[model samples]
Target: MTLDGHCAAEFAGVQAAFEAEFAAGNEVGASLCVMVGDDVVVDLWGGVADEATRRPWVRDTVATTYSVTKTMTALAILVLADRGRLDVDQPVARYWPEFGRAGKDEVTIAQVLDHTSGVSGWQQPMTVDDLYRQPDAAAALADQVPWWTPGDGSGYHALTFGTILAEVIARVTGTTLGAFLESEIAGPLGADYRVGMRGGLDRIAPMVPPPPAHVDLASLPADVEPRRTLGNPVFSAAITADPTFLAAELGAVNGQGNARSVARLQSIVTGRGRAGGRAFLSAETVDRIVETRTDGVDRVLGVPVRFGLGWALSSPAMPGVPDGDVCWWTGLGGAVVSCDLGRGITVAYVMNAMAPGLIGAPRPNRYLAAVYESL
Candidate 1:
């Protein structure tokens, strides 16, 4: 279980932790990256991408990292805001009038970015296929009344974050979120990340969900918030690998990239909106990331969370993250990306093997601990 890629001598401990993860069978195929200021201190990947085929995870190999895609979606919005084209303080309906319906006229772009917009999930049941159609997906969520009052508290908008953000982006830019992201964010920085699959189709690693895969959705009470938020549009790792799902612009969940690309793009926020010799956002815009728009127990996730713009604020719920003006987020399985503006550090971990829960899984946390230890 030899690890691939380079690790700075000082951060060799972090590399060892990554190898141990794969050696312990905790990671089928994964990539871990750490960036300091402008230098990449650590880059590593290993293990079988496809168990059935025995294909090794290589440089270009990417996986459908679930909600970590949210960071990219949110970054696109931040870029728009930095350009003075959009204001987080302004009502989203001002840009997309259709979004103002059902007591949502007061909901601002900041609220949506922070997941306190109250339209977390579509009250109407949605399948992965239905969400593929951009217009239909937007309409389903627009027509429904919010389950809670808008801006009351954070309810993790698991799937609808991208759908709602897409409408706003399209209305303002006259382009899809994926296209805008490619042109404005990923393209300028030359990062390999994508909102939807467009290139390197053969390099994607198939997701392997944790064993005993089926969750006990039936055990939870019918009215539980997690059940309501996650159950409405329930899906598994298998759905993420589907060709139709991959082709669609499901930005909240369907991003395809590896640890290298993730750290590169996110370093823009930690790097004061500049990366790869380009300035995609102004310092004022990057500062908005830690504005603390919402704080308290998350309705959907059933845990304490603090959201600032589009990233989660450092809090007790998220252990292993350093204390400072930092923000982070995770994908559905075990994928994670943390941007520490105070420390000028960005850490990202992307894996094909799906862990059971969403936030702060142990494997990535151990790697995080080792990274901080080295620092």
Candidate 2:
């Protein structure tokens, strides 16, 4: 496992941890990046990106980072709030009036950002194609009743988080979420991340599915939150390899990038809403990320989560993340990204070979431990 990349002399432990994972047969193709303030402390990648071609995972290798996409979408919404284009506390229907239907008239943008809007997943049946048909998917969500009472507790809007919010972004910004992200955030920061990939199929490392988790959706009652939310459009990890899926702008799940790109983009939050010598968000907007919105057992994920505006706050559920002004999220397979405002650090890990489970996968946690320990 010849890992190729740089690690600052002081953070050799982090590099060793990364190499250990590869040596232990845990990573096929992956990248890990850690940035302190404006400096990139560790930027590393290695292994075969495509098992078929045995393509090397180089510096620019990008992959579909499942729910980690949520952080980018959240950043977009927070930018809107910072610009006064949208208000977090205002009713979401104020922008997309159609969303007010089906007893969601009072749902707030803050609730949507924090995953407490109760429209966790679509009530109607859907296929992967339905996700690409944004208008139809948005309409289906706008028409359905929330699975739980609004703001009662989060249900972890795994997929719908981006779909429902993208409509609001389009309504408010006069541009698609991907376009907005590129024009305002990713492009200026020089981050090679995209909401939906345009023409870089050759660069993408397709996701390899982990051993399937045994969850009998049929045995679980239809009305159960996890069954309702995760099962409505039960996604296969292999869907990430489909070009159509990569092209479609599903902000909640289909973000494409590697660890370095993710760290670069998220550095905005860690740098107090300013990165690359530009102010993308006000310091006040960055402060809003730590404001707790939901702090209890999430109905859908079935784990205790502390969701803030657009990211998860440090909590017991995520054991290794350092406490204090920290916000983070993870993708389905094993991609993880975090911002520590107090210490001005951002750490990101992305891989093609996914470990089983969603949040708190051991791979990222082990890397995170090395990072914090080095500090």
TM per candidate: 0.97, 0.98
Q: For each candidate, what is the lDDT?
A: 0.86, 0.91
Q: Which ten residues in a row are the worst by lDDT in model 2? A: 210-219
Worst 10 residues of 1 by lDDT: 210-219
Candidate 1's residue-wise lDDT over 217-245, tens digit each? 66788776677778877877777557777
For residues 239-288, write the lDDT of model 2, one tens digit per residue: 87788899889999999999999999999999999888889899888898
The candidate that wins on TM-score is 2
Each model's RMSD to truth, in Å? 1.4, 0.9
Mark the regions of model 1 whose C-alpha exceeds 4 Å error after superposition. 213-215
After superposing candidate 2, which stretches have Cα over 4 Å from the reference?
none
